[model samples]
Target: MRRYGPAVLLLLTGAAILRVALFTELYLRYVQAGLRPYLVGSGFLLVLLGVAAAAVGRREREPHGEHDGHHGPRIAWLLALPALALLLFPPPALGSYSAAREAEQRAAQGIGSFPALPAGDPQALTLAEFSSRAVYDSGRSLTGRTVRLTGFVTRDDDGTWYVTRLLVSCCAADATTSKVEIREADAPPADAWVTVTGIWHPKGRLGTDGAWPPVLDAASVRRVAQPANPYERR
Candidate 1:
């Protein structure tokens, strides 16, 4: 039990990571979608390594009446922490708290010309994509289009409103916000997911993705159920 305890913990950790990454929305809060395969492979590898280690431990069991590291039960409580955390208190997706940091990073990246939006009258656009055009394209593409933007609410101190989405590069730790300032309509409570349909506000004062996030002259605000994926890729 002791000698193979770490292997068991490795198995559990891998299982927890795999299950969360594969089966639950919780994975969206921590990692990018593209990383799922690696997580699954890692879990399987851990389980296999643990099994092999346990097999070797059993084969090397010392003769009777001997107290050694092999026979002694090794309990690695520390190894169980990650699994325990994921199993107990799952993580929530990044919200307004992280919006500020993400916005700053995006603004600093220096906006460049972006590709044209797909052919559609009210094209559904992610916050990151919209912000890129808003900042870099200089309103060349979005000037007259009625676009649909979906994200959660983030209110500024002066009663301003925004519909925002966090962009994940590698993981949540490296996540950044790409939001749109809401003009002409009141928004829902902070962090409440909603889809806004409106035209882009011809550029705006910029500070951060959170502070400015470009501008959207929202014509309608409809609160919708949160989508399965919150963080938009790239």
Candidate 2:
């Protein structure tokens, strides 16, 4: 058992990776969809290597073969525990805690114009797009338009709640917060997914600090299940 410790660890880790990357969509919780192929390949490679290592260990234990019967460090199994945990119970996607930790930061694009929204009664828009138009669009593209946005709930100490989503360039490690202050509606629960439909409530001058986090005068807020891909791709 001691001699096969490395092989067991590798197999457990590889199975965990395959469990998420090949068997389920759970991988999206930590990485962009584009990386799924790479993850699948890596997991397959690990499993192959693990099998090879186990075969070599078995050959070493054969009669007349040079072998050390001594046990390995007991603590070495600790390295494999995380892989087991992930295989059985993967961690949830990043949520309010991640959003709250992010400092308020927006690009210095200055005031700019936005294209007219497509004709629709209530346009579905991403939180990032809504925020950008609300904060920096000189054209005020969101004004008077009924828009629908979806995100998990997050709150401030002052009781102000937001519909927040994280935008990632590649993976959750690079995620950045994008949120909107939802007004006139009761917040569902912290980290609960919700769809907010409302008209833009403009505040402050365009392209200034005051316009950040753009407010929405919500007409209706509805609870919804979390999406498969929680993070928005940048």
Candidate 3:
């Protein structure tokens, strides 16, 4: 067993990767969709290498040199534990706990006119888009449009609640929060996925610190299943 430790570790790690990237949508929790193929390829290679290494180890005679009892450091086996756990039980996507801990940081965009929203009673919009238009659109494109936004719930220390979503340029490690203050309705449970339909409830002037977070006067809050890809592409 000691002689094959490296093979076992590689197999476990590859299996864990395949469990999320090949067999399920769980990989979306940590990485962008574009990375799936790379992950799948890497995992496949790892599994092949592990199998080859194990076959080589089996053919070797027992060593009797000074390192006869040593098969690398025993402590290195601990690295396999995480891979085993991930294979058995993958973790959920980042939620309210992560959102709450992040400070508000919007990318700087000049206040400008946005294209007219499509004709509809309620337009479905990403949380980031809604936030951008609400805070920086000089044309006030959202003035009369009823919009539907979906995100998990998060709350502030003052009891202010927000409908929040994370935006990621590449993966969860680089995630940033995009949120809107929900008003005229009670907040759903923290981390609960919800679709909020509302009109813009403007506060402060556009492009100012006071206008941050954006505001929505919700007409309805409906519970929804969490999306497969929880992080919006930045």
The number of the candidate with the highest lDDT is: 3
| Cα lDDT of model 1 by residue, 1-234, tens digit | 566666767777777777777677667778877888888788788878878877886777555776664444444566677776765677778888788555355645554556677788799988887777777673378778899999999988999988988877798887777778899998789999999999987645433333355888888999998777788887
Per-residue CA lDDT of model 3 for 1-234, tens digit only, reads 667888988898899899899999999999999999999999999899999989988987775554665477778778788888978988889998888788889998999999999998799999999999999999999998999999999988788899999999999999999999999999888999999999999899899999998999999999999999999988
Query: How high is the CA lDDT of each candidate model?
Result: 0.77, 0.90, 0.91
Q: What is the lDDT of candidate 2?
A: 0.90
True-structure RMSD, every candidate: 3.6, 2.1, 1.6
Task: Please identify model 1 stretches exceeding 4 Å from their true place.
Answer: 24-26, 57-75, 107-120, 203-212
lDDT at residue 34 of model 2 (Cα atoms) = 94
lDDT of 2 by residue, 1-234 (tens): 666788887888888889999999999999999999999998998899899989988877533564354656778878878888977899999999999999887876878899999999699999989999999899888879999999999999889999999999999999899999999998888999999999999999898888888999999999999999999877
Off by over 4 Å in 2: 62-71
Clashing pairs in 1: 2-73, 2-74, 102-177, 103-209
Model 3 lDDT on a 0 to 1 scale: 0.91
TM-score of candidate 2 to 2 decimals:
0.95
The CA lDDT at 219 in model 1 is: 88
